[model samples]
Target: MPRLPIIHKTQLVASSRLFQVEEVHLEFSNGEQRIFERLVSRGYGAVLIVPMLDNETVLLIREYSAGTERYELGLPKGKVEPGEDLFEAANREIMEEVGHGAHHIQLLKRVSLAPGYMGHHTNLLLARDLYPATQPGDEPEPLEVVPWKLNRLDELIAGNECTEGRSLLALYMVRDLFMRLNR
Candidate 1:
């Protein structure tokens, strides 16, 4: 294996209410040096939940994304609050975003979104045995709950609305897990 680069220095370059950008200087083993900017992570990361409405249906939410400036269909997710476990965060997010709480929740995987630049990590969870519930969320507007057929994920990905990579990845992971369990 190649040796990891040595981070010689790090400096904060920018800051906002939600994000902090930092510049890191690294020296490679081959006498190469480079400086890179990354969005530093805060808090206990996040959780993205794939809520199964039934064996074939999955619940998604259509929420307006500030980054994209439009409503995007994606799985329910939120940052893990201080002192909250990953399962607690997943259940809370599903209730807030999809109006349901899961009786069964399992951690599927931990994933990163653009590891080359961002330090954020998200835990993908599979939630099943849902019951009707709701909790106040920080969303500016009510999220539109969208029920999608798991078998037709290809169609969902083909559309322009479901563009969030993390959500899409979670959906696929859940589908694969369901298939394995049934087999």
Candidate 2:
């Protein structure tokens, strides 16, 4: 079997609100070459959290995703506004999507989504000690908010119930943090 080609160079093809698609040219170790073989771009996003309320419950949101064409359960998340810092974006999204603001916010992690093919990255945030704040004047789209305990968190993660990418990452990271604290 022939070895796959490696990308030797990339050039910007086009850019949009969230990302820039690039065309990559590649050369195989065995001397084969290809042009414009890959499309890549970065998307900006924020991940918000509803931390354990009283050591047991977590706030979650359920809604239908047009992109996935499925009803999904996850925490509040959305694209970062232009020129917005990731942490600020997370806080803004949480309030907009979940109707609660984070009193304490910690950036848990920053990761790339499918770096091999895409340029999208997400910031995972752990927010705790939430309280009711002023709601957005424009009505938020329909969402179902529910609280679940730590025991049930695994069930949500295992069952593919939390389909939102950033939400799942944040949840898993928080779960790991909790496990470490208990030890």
Model 1 segments more than 4 A misplaced:
none
lDDT of 1 by residue, 1-183 (tens): 779999999999999998999999999998899999999999999999999999889999998888889888898998999989999999999999999999999999999999999999999999999999999998888889999999999998898989989999999888898898889
Task: Extract clashing residue pairs from model 1.
Answer: none
Which segments of candidate 2 are over 4 A away from where they belong? Answer: 1-20, 27-45, 48-50, 137-140
Q: CA lDDT of each candidate?
A: 0.93, 0.71
Residue-level lDDT tens digits of model 2 in 104-148: 788887777777776566667777788765356243466777787
Q: What is the model-wide C-alpha lDDT for candidate 1?
A: 0.93
The lowest-lDDT stretch of 10 consecutive residues in candidate 2 is 37-46
Candidate 2 at residue 40, lDDT?
A: 55
